[model samples]
Target chain A: MNAISSFTASLPGACAQGLIWGIMALGVFLTFRVLNTSDLTVDGSIATGGAACIMLIRSGVPAWTAALAAACCGMLAGLVTGLLHTRCRIPAILSGILTQLALYSVNLRIMGSKANQPVSVDKYSLMLSQRYVRAAGLSNPIPLLVMIISALIGLAYYFFGTEIGCAVRATGNNRVMARAQGIDTDRATILGLIVANGLVAFSGALLSQYQGFADVNMGRGAIVIGLAAVIIGEVVFGKLLALNFALRMSSVVFGAIVYYIVLQLVLALGLNTNDLKLISAVIVAAFLTLPNMKGGDRDA
Target chain B: MLEMIDVCKTFNPGTVNEKVALDRLSLRLEEGDFVTVIGGNGAGKSTCLNAVAGSFAVDSGKILLGGVDITHMPAHVRAKYLGRVFQDPMMGTAPDMWIEENLALAARRGKKRGLKWSISERERAEYRELLAPLGLGLENRLQTKVGLLSGGQRQALTLVMATLKKPQLLLLDEHTAALDPKTAAVVLELSDRVVQEHSLTTMMVTHNMRDALAHGNRLIMMDEGRVKLDVRGEEKKKLTVRDLLEVFEI
Candidate 1:
């Protein structure tokens, strides 16, 4: 009974964390599902965002400006990866790995060569904080997270409906057709990477504010978590949300929430915290295999 | 409207696998000429069309389109004046996109694509009118994904897209090669109608001798990366598959 109560108490905190990570998953979805490229840069870009945001806040920058600046820094990282892939002729996965590996040193520099840094909500005004997780009215983080997610989804929907966005989609769907139709596919790919990493860093910025600290390893295994959210969203809400792009994105956030809730339940059941990464891997692997199993059934 | 002057291209130069794909190939087209190209494998029929489409830069010589030199233009930049249909049915259209969306993309081929909505109400109506005449029942299924369409249907749609904006030059690189015989015939007929309607300067490459003889006003047979036979007017009208076979010794 004590364990059950504790698990229930952790649900709100888990939901808030899931929502924060959902933004990162949306970034992953842009590359993994939309652009048909698996980008591993999120692992480092997320930490870069956290480190940049915390450092900027410590320097007396406003929290919102710091977050935006962090996102811009993330975009620069994506630009390097894009140039490496398109100009230098590096393979897509390899380019992402290279950028991620390089960002480790860059992230350490951003945090003043320290492994971790903390930002106190009492010392600096944060956009959102864990102290407000269960607070009533406007101070509660859930409503603000929901509002921010809705705005992001709205912006994304509008962007994708535009002509330039259609070109990006075409570039993703068929490069030959896109080029034949006069779209510079290389430019489109670079633009997509820039936008995807910006969102990832923004998520990391909010996460650091919520947790009150930025660590060099904060973003380790981030790509796996993001992929887990994406796969879980597709397998669970694919049928219901497949037709509408906005709904599909919303499903991804819900998938993240479900993942955290499950994690909270497991932890409440006496699971070791260090085994969390193993559990995440298992979950993602299971979900990834589900579609292939269905395909096999059809083949047989 | 189109000219390739002494264009040459070689693959794997300085290597044991060196192969000369285009050897000083020279060709010219009048403003409204419908030229059919036929050749054996490695005879550079498709290579010639690709050269005109700016798929690769030639080692020497210039490509002039509408009296403007475009030898150094990249493929996507040169696409402003060219409409291309590839041999593979899957190569010309985005399978995951809707039919109407594909048409919208084609409509803005040579134009700048800004933040404007991808498909307008006016353009949607125009696309419906354009697709209705195909008799493929595609007009009513504008929202259907292109991947769900058959090979013939996709080829037909690609033909429509290629002609939608009335390009300065239309390139049909064995556009009907992958379809069944009946579908091939249907696509051929559609291609002819669209070409005649627009009076588009076209270069169609085909392996079928009968198709080569039946369709275009001009016929050119390629051999060893150069034009071996150029027939037109009464001479082309009088020529048969037997004459072509005898000339090429196929």
Candidate 2:
């Protein structure tokens, strides 16, 4: 009974973490599913966002402005990966790895060589934080995070419906067709990576603010987490969300919430917190294989 | 409307797999010309169309469309003046997109894409009207995904899309070679109708001899990366499969 109560008590915090990571997962969906490319740059850019946002806040910038700056910084990281893949002809996965390695140094420099930096919830105003997760009224973090995610989804839906957005979709679906129709596919790819990484960085900024600190290693294994949310959402809510683009985006976040809730449940069951990454990897691998295993009757 | 002067393209130069795909190939087409290309395997028939479409950089030579030099232009850049239908129907349209969305992409060819909605209300109506004539019942299924359509339907849709913007030149690279006999004939008939309706300067590559003779206002045979025979107008109409076979044997 005591364990059940404690698990219930921690549920709100887990929910908050899931919502933040849900935004990150949406970014992953854009690259992995929409653009048909697996970009590993998010692992590093996520930390970059947190670092940039926290540092800017420390220098007295407003929270929203700091978050935007962090997103732009993330976009720059994506641009590097895009150029390396499209212009230099480096393979997509390798290009992302190269940028991710370089960003490790860049992130450390952003934090002035510090391994971690903390922002006290008491010292300054924050958009959302753990302290507010359980608080009453407007101070509760759930409403704010929900609103942010909704707004982001709306923006993404609108952008992708536009002429340029269709072109990008075509580029992903059929590169030869896109070129035949006169779309500058290289530009479209760069734009997609930029948008995807920008969203990832924005999520990181919010994550740092929520957790009350920015750590150099905060973004480690972020891609895996984001992918987990995406695949989970698809496996669980895919039928319900497959009708429209907006629903699909919402399902990704829905997947994240489910993931965190389950994580909280397992942790409450006495699983060591340090083994969380291993658990996550196993879960993702299992889910990813489900589709292939079920449809193995036909050979390609 | 199109000219290729001293065009040369070599694959894997100086390597064990080296092959000359286009060797000093030259051809010219008047505006509104509908030319059919026939050749044996590796005769550079498809390579000629690919070169004219700017698929890759030619080793040396000039390609001009409507008297404007396009030799150095990239494929996508040069697409502003060309419409293409590939052998694989899947290569010419995005399968995941809606039929109307695929048409919208083609409609914006040679134009800058911006923040406007991909398919406007007006454009949707226009697409419906354009698709009505294909007799494939596709006009009613504007919201359907292109991937769900059969190979023949996709090719028909692609033919409509290629002429949607009235391209300066239309290149069909064995556009019907992959289909069954009935579907191939349907697509070919549609192709001829579209070319005539728009008077599009067209180049169609085919391995089937009768199709090469039956369609197009002109016919040309290629051998070993060079033009072996060029016949047009009255001469093309009178030539038979036996004559082409004789030339092939020689």
Candidate 3:
């Protein structure tokens, strides 16, 4: 009974964290599913966003402006990765890895050579914070996060229906067809990576504000977590929400929440927190193999 | 309407697998001319067509399309004036997109793509009219994904896409090679109708000698990266598969 109450108390906070990470998952979906490239830059860019945001806030920038600026920084990171992949002729995954490795030093520099920085809500007037997570009315983070996600989804749906967005989609689907149709495929690819990393950094900015601190290692293994959210969302809500683009994106958010809920449950069951990364790896691997196992059954 | 002046291209120069794909090959197409290209394996038939389509740069040559020098233009920039259909049906269309969506993409081939909605109601009606004549029932299946269609249907859709906006030149590189004979004949007939309807300057490459003789007004046979025979008008009308075989020394 005691453990159950403790788990219930933690549920709201878990949900809030899930929503923040959902934005990052949406970014992952853009590269992994839509653009058909597995970009590892998010692992570094997320931290860059956090570092940039917290430092800006510390230096007296407005919270919203700092977040936007952080997102732009992430776009720059993505541009580097795009140039490496398209212009330098490096492979996509390798390009991401190189950018991610380089961003470690860049991230540290952004944080004024510190590995960690904290922005107390009391001092900085943050947009959202964990302190008011379970509070009622306007103070609750859930409603605000929902509103932000809805706006993002609406923008994405509208943009994708437009001519430029369709060109980007075609670039991902078939390069030969895209070129034949007169699309600058390399330009389209660069634009996609730029937008994807921007979203990832924006999410990181929000997460830093919520947790009241930014750590250099906060974004470690971020790609796996983002992939977990996307795959879990598809596996659980894919058929039910396969109606439109908005619903599909919402499913990714819900998937992130479910992942956090599961994580909280296991933690409450007395599992050592040190093994959290191991558990995450196991969960992702199991989910990744599920579809292949079904296909193997047919072959057998 | 199109000119290739002494274009030369070599694949993997100085390597063991080096090949001279085009060796000072030159060809010109008059407006409204429909030419069929025939050649054997390694005869540079497709390579010549690709060179015109800007698939690769010629090592040393000039390509002029409609009086503009486009020898250095990239493939996508060159695509503003040229339409292409490939040997593989899968190469010409986006499989995962809707049929109407695919047509909408082709409709904006040479135009600037902006923030405007991709498929307007007017364009939808236009695409429907275009698909109706194919007799493939694709007009009713506008929302269906192209991947679900058969190979023959895709090739037909690709043909319509290539001609959606009248191109300065059309390049068909053995587009029907992978289809069954009956489907190939249907697509070929459709191709003839569309080309005639638009009076398009078209170059069709095929391995089948009979198809080469039957479709277009002019025929050219390529051997070792150069045109060996250029027959047209009265001479092309009297030529047969026997005459072509004699030229091949088979």
Residue-by-residue lDDT tens digits, candidate 2, A44-95: 9999999999999988999999999999999999999999999999999999
Q: Which residue segments of model 2 deviate by more than 4 Å? A: none
What lDDT score is found at residue A33 in candidate 3? Answer: 79
Write model 3 residue lDDT over B100-216, tens digit each, in one string: 989999989989999999999999998999999899999999999999999999999999999998999999999999999999999999999999999999999998999999989
Best by DockQ: 2
> What is candidate 3's CA lDDT for residue B242?
94
TM-score of 2: 0.98
Q: What TM-score, computed on C-alpha atoms, does each candidate reach?
A: 0.97, 0.98, 0.97
Each model's interface RMSD (Å)?
0.6, 0.5, 0.6
- lDDT assessment of candidate 3: 0.92
Please, what are the lDDT tens digits per residue for candidate 3 over residues A100-213?
999999999999899999999999889899999989988788898989988998998898889999998889998999999999999999999999999999999999999998
**Regions of model 1 farther than 4 Å from truth:** A296-300
The sequence of per-residue lDDT tens digits that candidate 1 reaches over residues A97-140 is 99999999999999999999999999999989998897788877
Model 2's CAPRI class is high
Error of 2 at A272 (Å): 1.4
